[model samples]
Target: MSNIIEKNVDLLKKANVYFDGRVTSRNYTDKDGVVKSLGVMLPGEYTFNTKAPESMEILGGKVEVLILSGLDNNWETYGAGETFEVPGNSSFEIKVLELADYCCTYLS
Candidate 1:
């Protein structure tokens, strides 16, 4: 069984912009774990790294992303408040062109 844990992030800063939201909760087990988080962003470009053993599922928002993992590098674009899944063991980054709000849950 996995245990649920709550995390909070009122805001995340990148390049003079702020991403605001609370990281609601997360669940973890011996073999796997899941983390849920949310963020709202004003128009800008930002970049971040993804640690291993983590996957991200976008619950909402619109943005463009570039993923570079294991020999596969590509650009992915999302629409308003869309859901998308990103596999673990991949390194990626994101860029936003407009005001956007998103929630993401990570599974491993």
Candidate 2:
């Protein structure tokens, strides 16, 4: 879970706001053409549905995640420098324990 600094990327001006603005993110295309988003999550629970496989990196805070499609079905906690992956066409539940800074990379 190294810190990711994306340079030479194309970013969208509009934000992706969800859960009544408790979560917000900006989508961007990195130099390598990978799609990603940088977002902040206030302490709240959120359910996200994904179209592509996603790698979620915890940048600064803590979160508990339960993958809807995973076999384990147990909630897992992640802190700074940790990451979790979710498969495409699946959904996940995330609980933010504190203000969380995160990066989500969409995988092909």
Candidate 3:
């Protein structure tokens, strides 16, 4: 069996609060067997467009965003701390209004 490890932001030596900055993360896998990450924009707006794998799912988040998925015609606005699940073989584009933070997690 594979050993499970849990990392807390409070206990991490590299974790620090950002007041007004933007941070982009590379792709990473989470403990829940999900590919999870975030693109943080402090006090400024940002946009992201990507093609997620078929099995990808948007678990939850807290930020205002416009979601344009291949499966949907109109854009979906996700409120603060919202959750979404993605279908297989789909693509999406996201746009954020104002300064916002978002969390993305994918399952394999």
TM-score of candidate 3 against the unseen true structure: 0.48
Ranking by lDDT: 2, 1, 3
Which lDDT value does model 1 have at 42?
A: 54
Q: lDDT of each model, Cα atoms only?
A: 0.51, 0.93, 0.45
Q: Please give, for residues 28-51, the per-residue lDDT of candidate 1 as tens digits.
A: 222334344545655566655555
Worst 10 residues of 2 by lDDT: 1-10
Best by TM-score: 2
In model 1, what is the error at residue 2, expressed in angstroms?
22
For candidate 2, what's the RMSD?
1.1
Candidate 2 residue-wise lDDT, 50-106, digit = tens: 999999999989999999995779999999989999999999999999899999999
Q: List the residue pairs that clash in candidate 3.
A: 54-88, 54-89, 61-81, 62-81
Output the lDDT of residue 60, model 1: 46
After superposition, candidate 2 runs with Cα above 4 Å error: 1-4
Q: Can you give the TM-score per candidate against the true fold?
A: 0.54, 0.94, 0.48
RMSD of 3: 7.2
